[model samples]
Target: MNFKNNKILSALLLLTLTYTTGCYKDKSNDGLTPINTVQITDPLTAGTVTVFQGDVLRLKPTLTLSMTEKMDKLEFSWLVYNSNGQISLASPRAVISNQYELNYLIQGEPFILGEPYIVRLAVKDTETGVISYINYKVSIGNKYGTGWLVLEDKAGNGDLSFIFPDSTVEHQIYSSRNTAPLVGPKKLELTPFVITDGISDVGKRLYILAETGSQEYNYLTMVKKFDYGFEFYIAPTIQKPTVMTWLSTTSGSTRSANIGIVINNGKAHSNLVGGFPGTKKWGDIALTPQGTTNYSLAPYAVGGPGVAAMIYDNTSKRFYNIIAFSNTPGAGSLTAFPAIANTPGQFDLNNVGKTMIFQDSSDVVHTYNSVMKGDDNLPYLYRYKTANTSTATPNLSISNIQMNAPGILNYTAAASSTNTGHIYYSNANVISRYEVGSNSIVETYTFPAGENVTAIKYAKYNFNDKEAVKRARLVVGTWNGTEGKLYYFALSQTGSIGSYTKQFTGFGKIVDLAYKY
Candidate 1:
């Protein structure tokens, strides 16, 4: 009666308690309470929605349930994890809402691109205490990337900086923009606007041409992230790279022509960088030279696309057709042209109108008696239109034109984007415009009285659009040894000087202003 009765009583009590409360949860309202299941009904599914850091994420998600009334008892929470799937405490969570702002680089954590984060939304049912989760992988892209990349040369030392539209300038960004510091201490030149395999926003590349190290002549040679100057695009190792240009990379395009480029370092040593397909790396262009001799180039325009360039040998002192020197794929070479006669012994050459517009020894004149006095050396321009290499021999008939009076000041000139007929030339403290067929200046812009004009280069190629109606901005450099500045200007729709636009200052001296497109 003691052992058997006690054991039987214990078993009967255990069965009765188990029936009263299923497992440990009370089942008194089991028949009255509802049974249901919930699922995320928006944002498609996992890996469906994509977002970038510091962007607005709108999630107006609804719930699909076995029964609809349970929606009222649902509670939602948001959670974000780092690329490593570690819960990022910095990522804040909010109640289910239509808009949620995401910030991956919050406070202590700075932006680390290519680091993917997973965002999960947890929705729980208060009645059942059941939870459902929907996940999304957020990737950082180059959306917040646009600006001007300025190249500076302190004495012989070279560095890079970035100036965004918001006026925030990142100085010496080369050190951080790439995995390695931009070739430094002796930056020879900056070649911006090299196209890359990546998309345009972040994929565009810039070459920080460095001075040859340990006596190597190849300048900086570090390919950089155009958006952030310091970021290196790839391993920095190139041979005597001079300049680059970009044309259509895809094969068999129906467009009118390819914007091919020709690069030359002195005796026309060549290196090209452009695309042949959408996935190719952004480096040396694809060139099938006519022969080994054709591998190099003569003097070619830096960003001149589909434009003819005159090849005047520094050693020969004689002007030759560019074709007589280098041959670029999809680009015609210079055809033979009559040798120039009685040309100035000294000249400055800037490719204007896709031809040679030279500033002679401030002396040569048109009249026969002009030589008796001496070279006027005024703002006179001698333009020679080199023929299309695929068509005919270049003509030597010169268009002897005059601009403002030229002095001993450093003068630099570049063609306008409006039309080849328009040109810009910078003097001591002035920027003057001239029309090819006109004998007088079309317009002139004088800098702040004493600011000296340092260099002139064409910028903002395809400024607003990349179509037939291309726009260009002229970047003029000026400095007083310690502080340097650049003045931006736009050409009128009709090729006239439009206005004095933006001014960027803060530098030792601007060695160059290559457009980062």
Candidate 2:
């Protein structure tokens, strides 16, 4: 009996030892494991967020783990610091989370503009108390808004030119009113450049065209201003003694800037092939569609070639150019090329001379084909559909004004088309409106006497000012013989023209205008 009892005790002991060993093995393999490491992948270290003040900014966070572990069990913590050195885990302007991704938004408070803020994100492992963190920087500023003006010194002269929503301001030479002298105007010898309205996804920028001359040669200069100012130039192979008109076209992410100079070959064909001298070379000044790069070049277009003008069609997302040539005539015979086309004869020949080109919202190119003489001669506005270039079509015909009229000599036309209607222009002095549906010049707004009407452009003027609403407003720079004065006019809808309310005037003549932020 004693031997049997001892055997049972030994068997029980063996069973307990086996159970203990198995428990130890299981704990070693799977229990009480420390998190190997934690990593934050996105919102990468020092990533940047660009947003306007008073806007909601969302910050997304991404994370990675040493193991393919589920994120549901993880805990998240976030912190943000302003330039002021204040600390906050939660901001009315921003939100944070512990998920694989974090999102933050700006609050309604008036935060500083053009300032940068800092943010920190962290993910904690609930099981092992492991945490991974990331830091980032963000900038705040205003997005592009309406109701603005731009000015440029195109002539590189000391004169200041400006473009407002309602008016074009041309400072007269030797006028007593010139107040603000542009930077480096006298040194640059900038004179008689071009100004155009530039639009981007975020907003618009004003471009000033000028020429800078060195002791040896001359080059075309392009100046632009937004948050900051930028200037660049292109060199032409040939030299001419006359003034040149700079033309530009933008389509999608592409842009082309060219100059038209009369070719002075001392021959009759010289007038036809190159009436405009110094416009021997074309330059590609392409801009990124997103407004990221200041300026860049894209591909070029090919065709029989002529003069080119561009208009952006928000609805179509394309740019159309009016290409006319000295050798090519007839409506359909003059082909319309997309700014991005990749074919030969899609662009004008190197020396084919053209007068004026314009584009509307429908991607149709309107060209003033008649060549005029002298700085005072103006061209007629003609229409050419993108699909049909064989026959010249009259879109907005002005009958009262004769080509090269005495006072209207050397006049240039500006045009703008919107869903509401179309505005056709002759210099800054006369503006004619046409309802798009009817395509007729329904109304004319002429500047008052002493307004320097010939300096006006439609796209550069402000139409939203209080005075502009009742009557169109224009930026006028006048010369009273002794000094040049800059004025902004608020005209009455219909009546005798009135004196302009001066905005800024002093010593410089207002030559051109541009809008900038």
Candidate 3:
């Protein structure tokens, strides 16, 4: 019990007392479990992410901790710092949890294309007084330009012209019928022209056939650029001159423009010494050595009244024709004939007595048979017969492939020998294509919901590995209140139709399209 003994006993007694009462309970790490740190899983980096103008961006956090951990008092605060560096937390608050996702739409004012923005997310533990924060940079842009010029119309005396990516403008060819006025001023007038192989011949001359006022006006129009400036011509009373080809025939005594080898009313007829009387009888004008004129029918004559002709066959040595008409007995009645005869070979005597002349590539004539009738009371196909025979037969024929939907307004068909024959047409809101040979209708494309399509064209363009002469493309023009827009669809090689990677918007209403390559 001396001084040294007393000090040692005091230290021993202190240790014994600490052990018995468990002083280590207050020293162990056990209070609020240190809040197992919060983190944002998405937007892991501090750089920019891009999204469309009206789309949404999601923000999420990755949490890792025991479920027994207290999370009821956790709170989240989202703050957005715009491009101008103004901070605002006007958005609603969220609770932090292990299995929750938060989405934020980066929308407010109209987002300027190609601009950068910043967003921030913060999580706090109210119980422990701890906070965590994260930030991200984002950008917005519109990559697609406008679309192609599908349909073109002229108003207020403006001469319509179209330029390609190279900035070369090709003036539309105006024909004589287009020059004449059918209705008085203030008529909602329009002239439609087709550009053959426009993609290949981007800046070259284009062939166009447009009606001046109505079928009564009947202008077979052709416009092209020769050595001089642009030149145009018009003939009267021709039906839709869908396709044109150049041919050679013996020069005859006809005063009609000397383009030889003319076919009319499904019959091949050369011009007599003088041109067919009146402008009404003039068929499609073919490019001739002298100039562009109606095809010549030497000995035979155009039989029916409506002289509508479309190209049927083309070869290096000769060409064939298909003429659509009505056989009903009347002044404007039409009678279709399918016959085969050698062209520019026989005139005067050899060709004089022949009627309904149509020939195929093998120089064989196809007899026209009464097959079908259209809504206009015209026989879609008349019985096929040889030049002098009247036996109904069917050797080579054309069939009408009906469209899928019925609301088609302004419809047109263009074909390329490269692929199966396909037709494209447009209604008020959508664009479509059909495979004629396969008899399959495909609603291959659609524009923005409320767009109105004016015209559609299919031309041959080279892309990928194949020489695509029959690639289906569409040029659509639409208006959103103030400005007109144009869109182009570059269909896939397999002829799958949709929007192309390229587009051109913000232009006037396109009235016509013509291309020469």
Candidate 4:
């Protein structure tokens, strides 16, 4: 073969292959489609938004789609971005909702309280396979995060005043949020951890008991969640609620057990809730050891972390030890206290004959104090030192003394602090401090004319120890016939009030106060 001819043919073959494969073509597509993107005319402001836990979050936004886009062809979804501000791949993103209008309860979400998370709304047009997103930073809060609840009587109607941690007051919050009025306000108590909803986690609750009716509200919102009668299988015939209190005992840092005692028309009802097989209703009236005797209980009870409650039967005029916390409904009963001999400074718990006027317990001293009135028309102070109820029989000790202090008989509102030796009582406009150790009045203060002390409470906030100064405060409520005022005084070590630290007014006949956490 001729070498030059063969080489020329090889070069021509290489040139032909390059022109057909490597050279790019410049041609417009004949039948290709452009993306149909939807536009949102209004979006949730693209910043941090706050929502309260357990509240309904409803968000609706009007959208302006492209001319070619149709509402039926759009798909929507909501998802939370991971910590890196992107959709997570290690874990599947759960779809919060798949609707244009979002309505959901802020519960059971992995997001933590007071922490911000990036939530994204995705809108897709299937025709163009394109998605648009709206992102918002959301944080969860509690409406009743931390405050003091003041239950008042406004012209014979029940009202509530909330005091924020910053000392801002919200008046008539209960009446504003609820349509059904709370009438004849009597007592307000916060229950220990309870299962408000059988599905949610354990939480505290607020009970507002009154002469007209009693009801339970969400501690976080003050919204009526359940009527007090709902807590009873068979509602009481006479729904006269005087008092309700929590019972619990602690050993070291562990709360061993807890229950609630409710006094309605002098009958006692007890229940243990917030756990498996939790019976979330009041049982039948508590029965005494004596068969068939309908003994009425005093309207006051004393129990705390280190002490079990002691109930006083005014019919028998004696004290009894409460049975252990039980899950069986209607099994609450009272047992007779072991009889002890009367001593110089102590009295027998089984045979004492006195009507309990006011009683409370202190976790610091593990002691319960009571101011009782005798049949002879005299007042006495009784102290009971209780041991932790970890054993079968707890060792109980008691001390009794007749209150001979000045203004003791004229006591209108009275309160004593934990481990403090002073008992503060009010006689109309005058507030007198009596020393329990010396059985004498130590200090006294008289308010301006026309102001009568209505309620006096000693705040013992166990949740926030940072509020140490506040825990030592003595909250005094006064009414000048029209408007009520709350005065918070920082009590000294000796229980003397020089002046008030804070005063919130504009309430109506403050009858009761409780700290909410």
lDDT, model 4: 0.74
- Which parts of model 4 have CA positions greater than 4 angstroms off? 1-26, 29-49, 53-118, 123-129, 192-201, 251-253, 272-280, 304-307, 325-331, 341-344, 362-364, 388-395, 460-471
Candidate 3 residues lying further than 4 Å off, grouped into runs, are 1-151, 154-158, 165-394, 398-405, 408-418, 462-473, 477-484
Per-model TM-score on C-alpha atoms: 0.51, 0.35, 0.35, 0.77
Q: Candidate 4 — which pairs collide?
A: none
Cα lDDT tens digits for candidate 3, 248-269:
1211232122222233323232
Q: Which candidate, 2 or 4, has the higher lDDT?
A: 4
Highest TM-score, which number?
4
lDDT of 4 at 354: 88
Q: Model 4 over residues 1-517: C-alpha lDDT tens digits?
A: 6999999999999999878665433233444566566776444565567888767767766677655537888999978644443444453456788998888787645654555666667899877778887776677788767778899999888999888877889887888778988888988988545434342335666789987768888767677877878878688878998877666665444453366678888888776544437456677777777644388888876665434566788888878766555554324677776655444666777778888777766434667778888888898888876664435444465678889766666678888877478788898998888787798887888899999999998875534335545557788999999889999888765677778888898999999888876
Query: Candidate 2 versus the native: TM-score?
Result: 0.35
Q: Global lDDT of each model?
A: 0.45, 0.37, 0.37, 0.74
Query: What lDDT is reached at residue 221 by model 2?
Result: 10
Better of 1 and 3 by TM-score: 1
Candidate 1 global lDDT: 0.45
Residue 427 C-alpha lDDT in model 2: 49
226 Cα displacement, candidate 2 (Å): 15
Report lDDT (Cα) of residue 78, candidate 1: 68
